[model samples]
Target chain A: MTIATFPPEPKPDPGWSRYFGFCTDAKVIGIQYIVTAFFFFLIGGLLAMVIRGELITPASDLVDRAVYNGIYTMHGTIMLFLFIFPVLNGLNNLLIPTMIGAPDMAFPRLNAVAFWLVPIFGSLLIASFFVPGGPAYSGWWSYPPVSIQNPLGHFVNGQGLWITAVALSGVSSIMGALNFVTTILRMRAPGMTITRMPVFCWTALAAQSLQLIGLPALTGGAIMLLMDLSFGTSFYRPEGGGDPVLYQHFFWFYSHPAVYVIILPVFGIFSELFPVYSRKPLFGYLYVALASFIIVGLGLIVWVHHMFPSGVAQWMRNLFMVFTMLIAVPTGVKVFAWLGTIWGGKLQLTTPMLFCLGGLFNFVFAGITGIMLATVPVDIHVSNTYFVVGHFHYVIYGAAVMGIFAAIYHWFPKFIGRMPYEGLGKLHCLLTFVGANLNFLPMHPLGLMGMPRRVSSYDPEFTFWNVVASLGAFLLGVSIIPFLLNMVSAWIRGPKATHNPWRAIGLEWLLPSPPPEDNFGEEVPTVISRPYGYGTGLPLVEHQDEIERRLDLQEASAA
Target chain B: MTDTTLTPGSVEAHGQHSGHNLTGFIIFLCSESVVFLAFFSGYALLKTSALDWLPPGVEGLEWRTPLVNTVVLVSSSGTIYLAEQFKARDNMALFRGFWLLSMAMGAYFLYGQAVEWSGLQFGFTSGTFGGTFYLLTGFHGLHVATGILLMGLMLIKSFIPGNYSGGEQGVQATSLFWHFVDVIWIILFLLIYVWQ
Candidate 1:
């Protein structure tokens, strides 16, 4: 009869100052990423508000035409590069190691380097606002000919800075994707087979793989564009016998899969939270996990759908149309799996659950419009219109952002060792859901009625929907107040959380709240079964009782 | 019970760690290859569409020095491989020798490239041909310089006693990168010099 003595507990949580410096601890880096990205998110949201304000009436009186272009371009660049991508990478840093029972990421220092590049390039991007030409007005795509024309004659122009920022961003993401794929593939604990891993990790694998394969094309393209703009390479100049459409091919090759890179993790969040809140195992779990790869596979061939109105050959357009529509199949499988998970189970409508539900509804709406946009006829008709704008907002904000919120709420306890105020959480969710629908829903009608996007002013007939959308945009702006208030207050003075507050079945839930410096310490919990074992009473880990006692002792000592 | 506990301080664990690093480096190289692919595809597209492949006054690329440069660069891959083999066999003297030889070959190749660039009549802004030519080769030359620098670091680190006591993963990764640079040059050689 041998009694096993527990190992020494890890050092206490380094206080808040750890985040400001170049720390290699994945948890600290994760929070830094999230906090920094949120700062950019607020900046992007403010830009959107300004744009909506300009479009409130039938005139471009609020800002100059050139300023409007810069505003929208910065808005798109900040939201995608700074907000969505970094925030998700932050979540990956926080969650992947804990879920897979690794003590740290594969290359922690490399991870820190990737994090610091965000701020460096993010500063460059924001600084372009103060530059000579006042930031890139050539849209986020920054296609050639227009992109190459540097009228200011200053070498350090807005388009130059934008391209430099984007190229550096591509480098940062490639480093991040490399780290993620290596960590997930190499660092899993004993008994955590590929199949037994949580679906979130699977989605991370798929999404990061897309980053590995697709990001370089855009990076390469950005470099060539920079060369043409600055060094007179003429790779995209028409007079220099360069093709502008080639840049479009390069940009969309990565940018189209980039949507999947954003949404796939949201899908993972949906998979994880549904089973926890609904008290049922994720239905067709294997299918849901494998479908992420399917999305990745299809996502690569479908970038030409974005070029339908760009004078692509008919065969190319039709081929990409089929590929784009095929994406809906895998996406549909995930939606079905979520519905089935919650169909007959005891549902807990917590803030996280509510957000997931809202996100799912919005995602389905977005998917339908996405399929419509996939069809060449419909896409050609609504090309460069508000309909395209409406559909993507439904995906990016209505679906992906809402899913991020759900993930934040669901994991807030684990992150900060406290329970968020449900009253405030629910209020925040209500405002966001209603405000988002009202803001984006009217764009469909406006697009069908022939109101083009990127214009500060519109026809007088389109003014009604614009008013509704602007009011909704203001309401959406208000929705952020409750969310910020709840996070700050709850983090400061909320009730302390237990190890497994939600009674979730995963390796992360077995650790202390705000898990120790090296998550799981010496006694890594070996995952025995797949995650999401809700209502099945199956033990998720091999030595569950022993691990729980060790965790409890650590928590007691820390307190 | 599928218990696959990797006990610390075991040889198997060390091998697994090295294997993990190799896999990561390979994946990184795969991504680098895609970046090159983007440029190559761009070159192919432009070549198919252009009315005149070369600028009006200038002749096509001179293949003599580039051919010698290609030979020098490609042969360096073999030298680096020999260095790794010697390091694996615990012959530190031969390992350092072959490693230095490989680095010299890489530097010689760079010198040949610079000489070729200096002699060229056309400049970067001359036309599509000059643009693609310089961009592809210059970009590739940058990679070669990076590989040489990595190899130089490895050579310096080897002099410190017990520097590689942990493992030779650094040397291995550097060699892999050198090889990747060599392979890319072959393709660039075909596209820019031979195919033209």
Candidate 2:
């Protein structure tokens, strides 16, 4: 192969101050998103501990009933909107342009605005605690009737702030979704056809598409709910001849698919990491890529499953149950594809791989419970029970959060140009896996035994499982210390990572570790083959030899 | 030598085939439409189920003013389209005239809505009918106001010579948004007035 000369690298990093300012660089904005999201994650985790403390006994001894309601409500809201969504957006900022060989996101300024909105809305959500009537006690779903009841009669009550915060989050995510979809569809390196793109991009496309189509309903609904609370519009109040069920329809229309928006990226993380750690090509790459859209199609129709127990028509319930069950087929396709990729390969058993494995295991369990909950009879039996809690926690905390940790660990080397301490990472993984199961698994039985959710006190008979879950939650809280330590210490002073540390075959790995300001500099790579060509000996980009040489030179100069 | 390297500028130029900003804006409009859909669905649901379609002791909406307003708003869509055409043909004067006319029409429609609101006996707190009616029209009225503001900005920008030299994507986006606002008004008129 002829060695081709490469262009000069772009300007060096602008140092740490760019992160604190309104920087438009996608990478900086991405790190800003991640760090800000992680801060909210710590807050959410602390609330979880408080919740566990209350649930440790069968009585509401740790906090007042209303206080407990505020804690758990904020916990769910912070974890979903403030943490998972923004961290995933951060990863999108860091990965999408580099993977596709674009210079930056389609709208870099919009991306920065999206990141800034996270902190804005996060502060709004946190500020609710100090407001009259405390935080929103109607849960994250914020279903009306209960939500519209402003007992304190303040115009700027907690529920009003909560609604405003949620509406702003909706606006931010919609903007983000537009940017991602446009970038993925329009911006790609030469010869990187839709099929040749990595599965992560495909998943991002699917997930963001859901955000575009579904989020607005929730936003519009929230605005109406806000009016009902503050302005007396009666969009949901029954005394004014409004229907409370309409709010449920509006809320679940997005909130149900909102789960998929969170998990699909985790699914993408799984697809990207499995092949790298297992030393194999992704099994059925085309199928895996196509499966994401299938999930999106199926995901939109299944929102009605969440409304099954809300006195929806019987025929509607039956139809939604089938739609909800059908989602498992596409999801199952991905799970099997991961298994097939890792089945007999030379598994690395790295920290990222371990987390992926644990995540996949948890996801399968969550999927089973999800299917069970989709059944009209089963859902009705455990509609408001702890069973519902256990099922989602397994998905959110167990699968999606674990998948996020995997991506962070997997890309840490690429993200910060340093290898995370493997010992700390493994300890974090073990504790998370054990604690997640211990925390959530017993909720299944509690739910089946008719232990209702969103309650501070429960029957004495439910105490044993609640104790186990509380202990598990405390352990889960402790699990974060090791991760934080690893990220900070490893970033500050760890072994330097070379590009392609895992020998991953993708455009991102073709660049120097931490990549340049403009990712590919002045010469963008022309993708020649599919990603995850681990054992095939196929080059990912044309001029692979020259690119490697140029990366080495760049690293040498930096050192 | 099969050379496949792409210059960084060319990489951007390659992706620029489809206008990135326009595409992003169109996607944004799709989300905006969904928000409107949510409100429409609420309105439809309440209309079907409520005991009184209109507030007690209040008559149905007067149709003549709203009908005239709808005609005015819908015609603005055509005027905005002409504005886009004139902008493309480099006729700045006609573009400015048509753009201003469209904004004037939009502002007139909002004025008509406010007048109609004042004429009504029932307020937002009257009943479900009053709530849905005000929310839907008020929301659409907000969009119309926004469209007028956007047109005003474009009109100002047009004064700076060579502003459209980089392509009239901004004008095109504003026109698209104005058209969307107009179309939503048609739907709102039919749902709240004509159908009722």
Candidate 3:
């Protein structure tokens, strides 16, 4: 007749086997995505090292042109598709339901299907390496004539496996997007309104909207390309009566917005981390959220920016130029907002916080470099050079990947009920940071000096920088060791983590660390006062009644 | 603040649509709209190019086959709407007949399109206009075929006692899908047959 304050004895759910489409345990699914993504991250990193090693000397020394193409192509593909997107979405799927006081995603079956489909699509892409001619040699962008004229494209794969891979991934993304949006919209507990949901959820919603709208174009493009290759209809071939430029138009149509798709959520993660670690509510929450939406919107129009030098009209070029420049304004709002969040608050220098701060610093430099590429004259010079390469790696690897690691380290306890080796995590962050800059920072100069991307080797003048870059890459490789060790060691013998290890005030803290098979015992969500009430003027007691209601609901259901 | 002030279920959740069928219809429209925009843009851009050629082999697309298909398709939309009206009024027999009639007319339209395709001289391989024509029409045809299949499934299910529960919302979702397909064909008819 008394409400138990804690689980009298850990009564894990036995009924979870019924929900078998996806891993019913949200934490398990989250870790599955994270660990697999981390594996790809290392593979991508190795490819990066291969690229740098080959470039270490001028004039085609280390690897042949074909292998070099495979290295960088798979590198970009794996990092973008296999690493950044999955890691972020995986984290979101893992965290958002728990964060918002929901027992599971509103559509858990769809969540399972989407998560599992990533590896399926991913293997098809990774499997391309062993194909007779080798992986998609037309570059990561896979621009036509070069891409379509090649023997191993969608047609020769004849299985439509390439198209199938991209589309399956697109399907996964669309489902994930829909689930993220619906869960945030419908399933929030009584008090958790639009304004009160976590910033990451808000960003995820915006990013997912971008995905839902943006991915269809890519799907349509891939479908058209598949038809072009398989059926000989000319979607992109002029000889077949299709224009290659049409493909570019359709391709950039998605790929440009995709840039935001990759970066914005990571930005969201940092947005959440900065405020939480700094012990401050996010500065300009409305602006940050609005900026995310604006970026998704404005991102659509700037696809032509990538095509400016490819013979687009001057006026069209200038139009995209202006839109491309305007992107900086919202981005500026975010940078200022983050700085504001960290400006005057108690700062936690935990490993996760270190990575967050490092990501911010690197992202600022990358943003500046991105702005430089937006200029007509500047882009004309560096359009196909290592500058573009360096710029993206900084954003994706330096900023987004770091943000993912920060989230993993920060939230590992919630998923696995054990802390990762913090000392190793810190060492990983430091080495990865130093090595990332050393590896990519000098490439800007190499690019300025006219070292082209996608080439096997460069001139002697570029030799020194490539060597430094290669050395840095090797260090980056070394840095990954700690993370892997930490993961393995934690899995083997780490101490069990306490619930609310960080004492963070979010609904996730209410659940058991590593959570139960059913997530929380209650099917219905209980309302909470605020998503981030810490450092706000709100009283802590505002959340207590709702928490008690959830506990009572769980107890009653159990009885 | 107390919980009493807020109404239960005030939260605006997605995935819930009623008789209006606005949400799914809108989503479908948005997707179709994007496809059409791509087609129109492709058309408009290509037409402006130096290759001022009509589809070379499509000289055989006599107006009659398309005009007849258009009539069949448009009338099926009306039939679907009438069926929805009858269902709303609980006229199960009328709903059943009209729904079947709508599917039949849809099948007839698709058959007409197939016959028309068989007669057409321009293949998808020929040129820009040819490729664009086949791609657009082919994609539209696929949608129509899917719509027909969905309606067939719904129609069969509706006949089984207690199968559909006379749910006002489920009936609306089906009606909306049919109406959407109907509207799409009207546009396709105008763009492909009449405009040319």
Q: Write one digit per residue (lDDT tens) for candidate 1, span A245-273.
A: 99999999999999999999999999999
Segments of candidate 1 deviating more than 4 angstroms: A1-13, A549-559, B1-19
How far in Å is the alpha carbon of A484 misplaced in model 1?
Answer: 0.3
1 or 2, greater by lDDT = 1
Every prediction: chain A TM-score:
0.98, 0.98, 0.92
Instruction: Return the TM-score for chain B, candidate 1.
Output: 0.90
DockQ (model 2, Cα): 0.52
Q: Score the docking of each candidate (DockQ).
A: 0.45, 0.52, 0.32
Please give the lDDT score at residue A38 for candidate 2.
97
Each model's TM-score?
0.97, 0.97, 0.91
Ranking by DockQ: 2, 1, 3
Tens digits of per-residue lDDT for model 2, A1-559:
1224353554565788888999988988889999999999999999999998988988889899989888888999999999999999999999999999887899988888988999999999999999988999889888878889988788888888999999999989998999999999988887789999999999999999999999999988888898888988887888888888999989898999999899999999999999999999999999999999999999999888888777889999999999999999999899999999999999999999999999999999999999999999999999989999999999999999999999999998997889999999999999999999999999999999999999999899999999999999999999999999999999999999988788888888987778777776446777778889899888887778777877788777868
- Residue pairs clashing, model 3: A237-A242
Would you list the rank order by TM-score, best first?
2, 1, 3
| TM-score (C-alpha, index-matched) for candidate 3 | 0.91
Q: Name the better of 1 and 2 by DockQ.
A: 2
Question: Could you give the CAPRI-style class of model 2?
Answer: medium
